[model samples]
Target: MRKFIQSIMLLALSAQLFAQSSDWVYATMTHESALSLQSSHPSGIVILATEGNVSAVQIQHQLAPSLKSGNLHGPGYIYRTDAQDAVQALTKNAPKKFNILDFTITEDMFVNEVLGMVSQENLGNTILELENYGSRFHTTSSGRQAALDLKEKWQEMAQAANREDITVELFQHQLTQQRSVILTIPGTEVPNEIVVIGGHLDSGDWSLQTNAPGADDNASGIATMTETLRILLAKNFHPKRTVQIMAYAAEEIGLVGSNEIATQYNNQNKNVVAMAQFDMTNYNGSSVDVGLINDAQFTSSELNLFWVELMEHYNSTGEHRITYGTTACGYGCSDHVSWTENGYLASFPFESSFGEHNPFVHSEEDTFAAMNNDASHSVKFVKLALEFVIEIAKVSTMSTQELNKTDIQIVVQNRDLIYQFNSSNKSLNSMAIYDSSARNVLSKNQLNASGRISLQGIPSGYYIAVFKDNQGKSHSKKFLLK
Candidate 1:
């Protein structure tokens, strides 16, 4: 009787192993990462092929629960297709060797002007608005609406700036209903070279139809990007290299959106210079203010060094000083992995260390109130992003040549506004100040020859000073009243 029972159990186990459905999906991940997943749940994963340090595996959709749970705990796998396809993709897009650009600091004044416009209130409001959605999970109706709403918001901002060069569009994917959003600002000088800054917009939990307020997991990251876009448009800033702000969809489900987009860009032979991903930027669970992922397999050492140098030069010491430490998120943790696999230089600046990430992520508990209902932590990331864009995509001379030629300087000191011109040919006829919302606060039709005006009743905050020259051309500068 004991022998018969053993045989029956063995037969059942074999049947279970071979009875898997044809709904299996192919993916490629590091050998170590694949082994870790299989060791944790032997019945959930199967390795199909291996080449060098990478392995291709066939996974069932039923294992989504395990994958989602493991994402909250340890490293995750990179999703791709068939073993042959995976190897071919890797070979076709093998990373090219190139020299790192010269790290220099020549745009201090422009960088400072943009960094001063960072607002905590704006970031918090964005987070609140995104959390109001039912769920941003892929394949859901709400997820698709969220993407459409964001597209409209970006289009409105571009219109307000009166810029015809800026274009906003939705990137549709074949696998998921939720579409990714892309806002492109065409470069003035180097239109071929591209720079990308992105974060995932979709959120998830155990249930797809119910509540899954992923405020900290990803809403925070999207908020950071939105605030950056807001300030850049308000300042009427134009870059020399094409800059794109991408809000990817379906990141929670094995980086599906980003992988498809990256693969397409690679196939087109797009010249993407560098990419940066901001995911989970609100929660401060670690000792340091910023955590820079230093994994060489999925990140660029040169890119990491560039950010470190930026921090040392721009945010070294002050009330807004940001301290950073190195960390690693195994393999295929976020959207940055997608870009890295496509032979692009990408970097991820995380909110906290690996083991110290937010404990309430991927559930209803990941709400704004869970992080003390504040966006102060995200302010640092906004500042860092400003510095990155200003340095990488230097200001375009075509758009600001008039102002550059005039060389006008405006300063506010002790309730008095002073203006000076390095070129004697330029003369200021009228001056006005506008708030960040583009509302004109104070205006003066006539000005004294001494180039001074009294700001007696103006409040202390961020404002843009617009000066009209004798030629009827306008020049603006951002200033803070303290």
Candidate 2:
């Protein structure tokens, strides 16, 4: 009851800041990047601060009650768009990125404090940032120019880091600045089919601030996403499908990064299966105590709920109460929105309660202290987010009906079954057929829209038909020859 009341108080205290939409937030972020060209050691110093411990299921569980309560101020509004922009957001965009300011600050504070770098000596100025982006173009030309300039600064910083031993160089996809990172623990029979876990690395601005250190805005997000990647990688268990972890870029600037990569795969029409986003998973507002709470409360129906259900495979957090699609919300700010917009079933793991939203996002204040913390189960929080990405996001979940709608359809001639299209999900496209040892069969081939082409002659016998679907989904069924 005390916690619930505290949550109400926090909401009442921060009502002014939490009312804005993500669209406004993105522009505000770019404004900050444009204003201050900080030289924080390496370019995109955001890359250097990675704790690799955000995936903790226990942590995720402890935060949900707060998430349910903090959703009041957020109405989960929707955005109206023209056909062109919708197409781009949903299809053409790919290669997203995840922000990690919260983790960075906490990790840095701890590391430095332990290293004896406390108040003794002066630490340099930290580059503050904020984010509310979904494909760089969502805002305006001003935002674009700002992003371009920020990129230039980061490039300069990254180049400088290259000269230093502390820098770890990684490739960024040319179009969206996205990086492809895959984690695979070999599958038993189908090592080719994969379950991908991912998040975009970027931030948005609501307005222009001189310093925009997106600590809670998304630094927390990337921290959780990366931590999830690390946990899955550390596990020795192998599943039926390979699990790939992708940290996308250009998410804040616009869902540009993830959209780019996802669209490319969509164009190829491969089975990307499902996608999940760890956007703002660090903050847990006050409404944690479930016993007492009035009608006025905040709630979050983001990707975390799905994650909670997914965790049932392991052991913990069995029930939750919130699941709103990105479209259900007004705008697509985070990278998961990119996947959802593109017609893919993607999830976003946002903060528990955004009531005490990050006031310092676009300013220099987006550091760790400005947001809420569940405190009890931080690691669990991170783990639940990833569990959803791995299980719910897997390709095998798709049904046979979804397969026929793709570029490839089932084709059968005589005793031969063939797949006539390409897809990323290997399980759906795995070929299956049955035939008797004494049966005589004729030749077969996949024709145009007509489907299967049979040879002139064939023998009567029982046989099974098999073929791959558009998303690389495969299926088989038995047939009686007459």
Candidate 3:
């Protein structure tokens, strides 16, 4: 009976191991690639699917070295987990808990710090430079070079900001020499809880060593995210949770780089609060300014709802009024799926709907010019990305003393500023909106009995929302118009 029980346990372990779907993945390599010999796969390995039984660490050591120098047609290769397989493996028997929204939105100081920092000129320049790289096909020399260049660029930006807390790193993967660039801002309070914003850096035209500018396909995403980082650094915005900005490598071929990174993070039980992805963000192909991907298989509904609420609050009353809609990009179409499969909340905000997406992507025609030589559309994404970070990371300390004194909740609703006072003891005598320089932009001397104050014709900026209570106490809250 003891021997039978032991055999039963062994059978159960074997069943679990074999049933792991993430182990069944695909490799993009020809028969001549060195990875072919290392893989237990048969010949003619063009997009071959294999089930790897090795540990993550063992796989990295066994496969990563040989992958350092190969192209699609040469002795190198790129590998990625099968999208469906990964999703199945990770979600099997997983609880369907909708994580509670547990964050506050108050950071006018951080908002003010970012003004004039997300430069359209700078964004255009970054896109142009990346386009000039000719191609960033995962296995090509230019691809690796582009990744290294981006790493250096981020490092310079951090140094220029004189921020020692920000560390830019190259996250190496086993698929290609191209390493993902990671910029981390360690949280002042909860450093372990993380918020991530990502975009893919590599571009391709379904061929290696080709001129795939991919300006709209992904350079726009990277440039927009870069601006977000620059502004955050410029403002010296410190949050309660770590904020990570990522530029993924080899995304055009498969979700290779991000898959490895997300898997490692999951295995280590990292507390990733949320992840937002920016991809193909420049081309305004649709009527809406942004399209939040609603694919249930590849996105988090709870997190996406937060984004909708954020837009409704910020973009509703601002001069730069942003319009948004929901669309679906199929599973594993981008890197956000990598995080999603690993049981982390992720979102993808695309430039437009699927039917109206930039048509020139993954081709030589995907140039900066293809995006009409404008970074205006992409600028909206930067705004959204920065706001996402602030909301998820939360403020380390309240910037306004009134926030501590009053139970008044403030938000923009339907192009009107609504201030909801929940405290029966607090009666508003007066209210005013002052710009960043403390200049009174809008003022009201009378307050209605309803305990709600609505204002209109206010522009987007950092402002001091000052309310005078009946007790003659001046309560002030820092407010961002959008």
Report the number of the highest-TM-score candidate.
1
Error of 2 at 320 (Å): 13
TM-score of each: 0.76, 0.42, 0.69
Off by over 4 Å in 2: 1-188, 204-210, 286-308, 311-328, 353-359, 371-377, 389-482
Pick by lDDT: which candidate is best? 1
Ranking by TM-score: 1, 3, 2
**Per-residue lDDT over 1-482 for candidate 2, one digit per residue giving the tens place of the 0 to 100 score:** 34643543354334325433322211111112222212221221111011121110101111111222333211111121221222122223333222111000011111111222111001111112223332222234433443444344333443443422112223345543334333334444455543455554444432322244455555555455444433433332234455555555555444455656665666675454455555544444434311111111111222222332232223222222222111122233455554554445455444443344334443455555454322222344454544443443232322423443443444455544444544444333233333332112432333233234342344454454444333432233334445
Candidate 3 lDDT tens digits, 250-315:
776557788788878887888888899888888888888888887666677656666665664455
CA shift of 142, model 3, Å: 0.9
What does the lDDT come to for candidate 2? Answer: 0.35
Better of 1 and 3 by lDDT: 1
Worst 10 residues of 3 by lDDT: 53-62
lDDT of 1 by residue, 68-157 (tens): 344472125655654445444444556643334443345667877788789999999999888899688877788889999999998998
Which stretches of model 1 miss by more than 4 angstroms? 1-23, 61-75, 87-93, 205-209, 398-482
- Every candidate's lDDT: 0.75, 0.35, 0.67
